[model samples]
Target: MKTKNIIFIYILLLSFSFAQSALKIATVSYIKGSCYIENSIQDKSITPLAGNSIMNNDIIHSKEDSFCDIIFDDDATKIHIDENTRVKILSDNYSRVFEVYYGSVFVSNAKTHIKTYIQTLNNNIYVNNNNIWVNSYRDFDKVVSINYNANIYNYISNSQIILKPLTAYNIFSNGSVKIDNNLDLVPDYIEDESYLQVRKENRNKYDVYLNDYDLIPVYGRETEKRSFDDNGFKLGLTAGTRYMNNNEYLTFGLFPQYKHNNFIVYSKLNVYYDYFLKCSSFDDCEFTESGIYSNWESKNDILEKFHLRYHRSDYNNSFSIYAGEIPQVTFGHGYLVNKFSNYYEYPLRSDFGVNIDWKIDNDFLNFKFLVPSIREYFRDGGIFGMHASLFLSHRFPLTLGLGFVMDFNQFSQSPRVYDVDSSIDSRQIKAFELDFELDIIRSMNLDVSIYGELVGIWYPENIFYFRSDGLMPFSDDLRWRRGTWGVMAPGVSLLIDNKHEINFAFNFNSAAFYPSYFNTNYLYNRSLYYLTAQPFDFNTLGFNLVGNQIGMLNDFAINSTNMEFFVPKELYPILTNKINVFPLRGFSIDYKYNFRNKIEYYNAISVYTQNVGQEKIKSQTYYTFDAKLSIKENILRNLSSLNFYVSNVFFLERDDREEYTFGFNMMFDLPSDVYILFDIGQVFYDVSLNGKRNNVLNSGLQLRLNF
Candidate 1:
C-alpha cells in the first residue's frame, strides 16, 4: 500500500510540472478586423487568428474600425480590444498583467477570482472578479468600473484609490486625479453588431459566462455615448446678422471639416453683405470707421479659416501641428506675447498661421512654435515665436524655459509715412526671455510654484530720423533706445483643486521697454506712437511717439525749450496679479490687476508721482474682471446650452472711464442633429478721440447642422 501511494504522488507531481511547462498566458478568441500580433523577442508581426496563443510581451494592435477579444488560460478572464488600440501582455504570473500604451480596452474578470492588473502611463488599476473599462491617451488615463470595485494605484503620488462601480477616474499627465460618480460604465462600442456577434459566438463555443446586462441591447443611450470616431466628414452652415457702428451686415458662412485618424482638414468661408437702411432722422445716421467696418475697408473679406492639423501622442511623446488660422498663441508666462490671435479680425479678415508643439519623454523636454500670420509674412512681414522648456529633475520639479519672438516688421501695419517725408524701414523687433520655475509643493489638491523671467527686447536702430544739424539726420538716442530690458521676478503661483489659480508678480522695466508687447490688442495698438518728452511737430519729418498705457497710447507729454528738450521717462514699476476661480463646472471668474505708481507728466517733459498724503507714491490701478457661465446639460428642456459672460475694464488713470462688455449666447438643440445659436453682445472700442470710448451693439443668430 505504501508503494502504491508513492506511485500516485509521483504521478501527481509529474502532471503538475507538465501543466506549468505548457502554461499559456492568453489566447486570441475573436478578431473583427485588421488585428495583428507582434512578437517582442523576434520583432515579427503576424495577423492573428482565433485560438492563437498570446505569450508574454506579445503586442496586440487593432487598426481603425477593428477590434479583438482575448481569453486568458483561466477561461473566465477576458479583454476586449477597441479600435485603434495597442496593448501588451507583460506577464503570465498568478496575477495577470497588461500594459495599455494607447486606446481603450474592456477587462472582464467577473467570473474569476484571479487578480488582474492593467497599467497605464499615469496609473495602475487592479481588478479581481470585476469588469472595468480603461481608456489611455498620451496625457491622461480614464477608468470606469462596470459592476464591481477596482483599486487604482497612482505611482507618481504613491496613493491608492478605490474605484467603486459606476464611478470614473481621470488621471492626468501631471499625476492629478479627478473622480466622477454616477456614470454609465458600459461603452457604446460594445453594442456594435460585430462585437455582439463575436461575443455571442464565443459564449457558445467556449461556454464563457457573460452577465445578462452585458448581453442585452441598450437603447436610448446613444446620445449620451455619442463620440467622434477616427474617420468622418462633416459640414456646418451659419446664417447670422450683426449690427455694429450704426451699420448692419448679413453674414453667411460655411464650415467644413474632415478627419482621418490623427489628420484633420478644416476650412471656413464667410461672406458679409452690407445691409442698407434708410435713416428717418439725422441723429440716427451716425457713421464711424471702427470695428467690423474697418475690417471691410481693409478688404480682408473672404476666407476665415483653412487649416490642416495632425496630432499624435503616446505615453512617452506627443506631436501636433496646425497650419491655418490659429486662434491664440502664448509663450512662457506671456511676458512678450500673450493671447495673440491671428484671427483678430475674424469674419472680415483672415490670417494663415502655423503652430507646432512637441513633447518628449513625458515633459522631460517640450517645444512650441508659432507663426502668427503666414499670409502676411511675405507681403508685409509677420511675427514668429518659439519656446522650449526642459524639466531638470523630478525630485525637485524645476523647469527652465527660453523663448524668442521676432516681429519681422513692427511697422508693417502702420501708416507708411507716419507724417514723415521718408518712410521708415521695416523695423524688426525681437524679444528674448529666460524663465525658471521651481515647484515648492505639488500635490493632488494643491500646487505652489515660484517663477521668474528676465526679458530683453531689441528694437531696430533708426526708428525715426531727426535733424541733428542742417540736412544731417541722426536717430534720437534719448527718446528711442536700441534695446531695453525688463524683469518679472519672484512670481508666485498657487493652484487649488485644479480649479482655482492665483498669480502675483512684480515687473520692472527700463523706460523704453514694454511688457506683453504682443498681446490680444496688439493688432489695434501696433500703429500707435509712443509718448515723448515733447509733442511731435507735424511740420517736421518725424514719427509720432507714444507710450504703453494699457490698450491706448500715452497721451501725456512734457514740454521743454531747446534741443536738450528730451527727458528720459521714468518707468514705473508694476505689480501684476491675476486670479481665476472655477467654483463649478462651466462657471468661472477671472480677474487681473496691474498696479503701478501714478506718474504725472508735465509739459516740460518731467515725470513725478505724488507722495503728499503718505510716504508711498500714489497708485494707479488697471483692472479687468470677467465672469462666465456655460451650461450644456441642465434640467431645462430644449435648452441644450447657454453661455453668458460679462467683462469690465477699469483704466481709471488713463481713460478715467469704465469699459463694460457683456454677451449672452444660447444654443437650442433641434431634431436631426441640428442646432440654433443666438448671441448678443455689447463691446467697447477706443474709437473716439482724447482717450474716450464708444460702445457697439452686435447681435447674431445662426443655424448649424452637424453629422
Candidate 2:
C-alpha cells in the first residue's frame, strides 16, 4: 500500500513539471558570457542560467563579447544574440515579437507558419520566411539579411524596402538604404552534415537542417528553368512613323534573340527612311549620313546592335562573372560613372567589358571594367575605364569606392580638331576619383561623404601644367592644365510613419559634383508616389536649394562649345585651379496630386540662378515648369492609354527665348502582344511665335510585336 502511494505522488510531480514547462514561451538554450534577464512584470533582474525558462516581457542583455541563444519551445525558432546586444521578448504567441535595442542578432525559424517581428530604432522588420539577421548600430542604422522576400517599414525615414531573397540591406534613419546581394554576418551558409552532428553534440539539440540550399536561390528559379529549344530562336519587331518640322520619316527595326541557360545572343538592325531622301530608282538612291553600329542597341536610327553574353553563379551567390555588353552602369548615386547616353547628341554608345562580383565569408566586393566606345567606329586610340566598390561591415559599414577613365587623345600636343589624322600626338587623358562614406552619428541618422577627383589632361610636352592668365591661356594654349575637384557633403534624413520622409544636405564642391556631363547639383530634392488603388490622393511634395560651381577641367574639347557651364580658362580666369569654391545658387519646388481612379497627374517647377561673388547674374535666372496627365483603360478587347504633357521654360529677365511645348500620346496593346503607339506635339517658340499663331507640328506612330 505504501509503494502504491509513493508511485502516485511521483506521477503527479512529473505531470506538474511538464505543465510548468509548457507555460514558458522559451528557454535559454546556450550561453557564453555576461547574459542577464530582467522581468518587467516582476520588476526584478537576474543572471539567466542555461535552460532557464523565459516568458513574455523578459528582457535579455548580452554584455560585451558575450553571446547567448534563446529557443522558443512551441516551435524550433532560435534567436542568437551577439556581443553588446539587448533584446526583449514582447510576445511569443502565434508570432514572436522582439525589440532590439543595440548590437546584432540572428533569427532562424524554418517553420513556414511561424512569423517574427523585430523592432529597431528606425525600422520594423516582418519576417515570414524564417531566415533573418538583424543588426542595430548605435541606434542609428538598421541592417538586416534574409533568405527570402520580406517587408521592412522604416518609421524614422517614412519608407519601405522590400528585402529580396539572399540580400542584405543597410537602412539609414533618413530612408536612404544600400542594397547588396548574398552577404551575411556570422556565416549563414548551410553547414555540412558533419558540422550539424558536431553542433548537436555540443549543444544537446539537433534542429536546423544541414543542407539548406533552397534557403537562398541564386538567380532565382526563373533563370534555372528558362532554356532554349533546338533552334534557339526568338524574334521582335518595331515599326514607327513620325512627322515633324515639315518632315516625315518611317522607322523600323528587327531584333532576333537566342537564349540558353548559360549564355544569350542577340542582334538588332534599325533604320529610318526620310520621305525627302527618297529616290526615283534604287540605283539613284543617295544617303546624307550613315548610321553608327555598336555592341548595344542605339537609341537613334540607322544602327545595328550585336551582343553575346555569358553569366554563371552559385546558389548562395558567392561568385558571379558577367561578360559582354551591359546596358546601364551607375555608381554611388551617379556621382561617378553614369554611362547612359543621350542619343540626340551622342548617337553611338556601348559598354563592352567584364564584371566580377565575389564575397569572402562576410566581406563583399565588386569590380567592373569596360570600354565605353562604339564598335563600328573602332580605333586603337586607347580608351579604358573601371570602377570598384567594397563593404567591410553591414552595420556601421565602411564603404570605399574608386573609379577611373583614361583616353589617349585629350593630352595630345597636336591641337584637337574635328578631322582625324596621324598628326595627333598620343597622350593620356587620365582621370581618377576616390570616395569614402562614414556614419558619424552612431545613434542618430547622420552621414558624411568625402570625395576627390582629378579628371585632367596630361601634357607630355610641358613639364609644368599651370601658369597665370598672362603666361598661358586655356582657350588658345595646350600646355599644362589643371583638373582637380573635391567635395564634402553632410546630410540628415527624417521619416514619419514609414510614409513621409525628408532628406537635407549641404554640398561644397569645386564644381557640380556629377561624374556625368548632365547632372543636377547637390541639395536636389524629389518626391515619388508608387501608383496604388487610391489614385485621387496627394502623394508627394518637395522643395530644395542647390549650390553649384564650374570645375577647373571643364573643357572637354569634344563638345565644350555646346555645354552651358563649360567655361574656358579665359572666360573665368579667377576660378581656375581652385577646389570647392563654386559661386552658383539654385532652388526648386515641386508637387504632385493624383485625381480620378483611372488617371494620373504630375507637376513640377524649377528655378536656377548664378552668383558671381556678391553679384547675382540676373540673365541666368532659368525657370521651368512641367505637367503631365495619363489615363489607361480597356477598350474593345485592347488595353488603351492616353497621355498629355506640357512644359514651359523662361528667364526671369528675358522673354524672347521663352519656349512652350504641348504633346499628346496614345497607345493600344492588342491581345496578341502587338502594340501600337502614336504621338503628336506642337512647339510654340517664344511669345512672338505664339502671337503670330506659328506652331511646328511633330507627330509619330509606332508598331511593335513581341513573342
Which candidate has the highest TM-score of all?
A: 1
Off by over 4 Å in 2: 1-232, 242-247, 276-304, 309-325, 342-363, 374-377, 380-383, 410-428, 439-481, 493-503, 511-515, 518-668, 677-700
lDDT of 2 by residue, 480-520 (tens): 22353323234333322222233333323332222232111
Model 2, position 102: C-alpha lDDT score: 84
Give one digit per residue, the lDDT tens place, for model 1 in 1-707: 99999999999997775555344678998999899888745556889899898876788999998999998764557889999989987654445677898999998763222347899888888765456789998887877765555667777777555554444567776666666332343366544311333434444455453222233332232223323243888888887776644467777778889998789998776565665555669778744332333433332323325778898754347799988777567777766766676654343335667889999865389999988666555557787899999988655678999999888876554332122122344556788999988877644345678987878888655222221222223233113346777667777877654345666666555533545566654543354322233433432214322222211111112122211111111121110111010011111122222111011111101111211233232333333343556554322345676767554332224332223446677888776778888877664443332233465566777787776
Positional deviation of residue 13's Cα in model 1 after best superposition, in angstroms: 33
All candidates: TM-score = 0.55, 0.44
CA lDDT of every candidate? 0.58, 0.48
Query: Best by lDDT, which number?
Result: 1
- How displaced is residue 440 in candidate 2, in Å? 7.9
Which residue pairs clash within candidate 2? 156-495, 158-498, 465-480, 509-580, 510-580
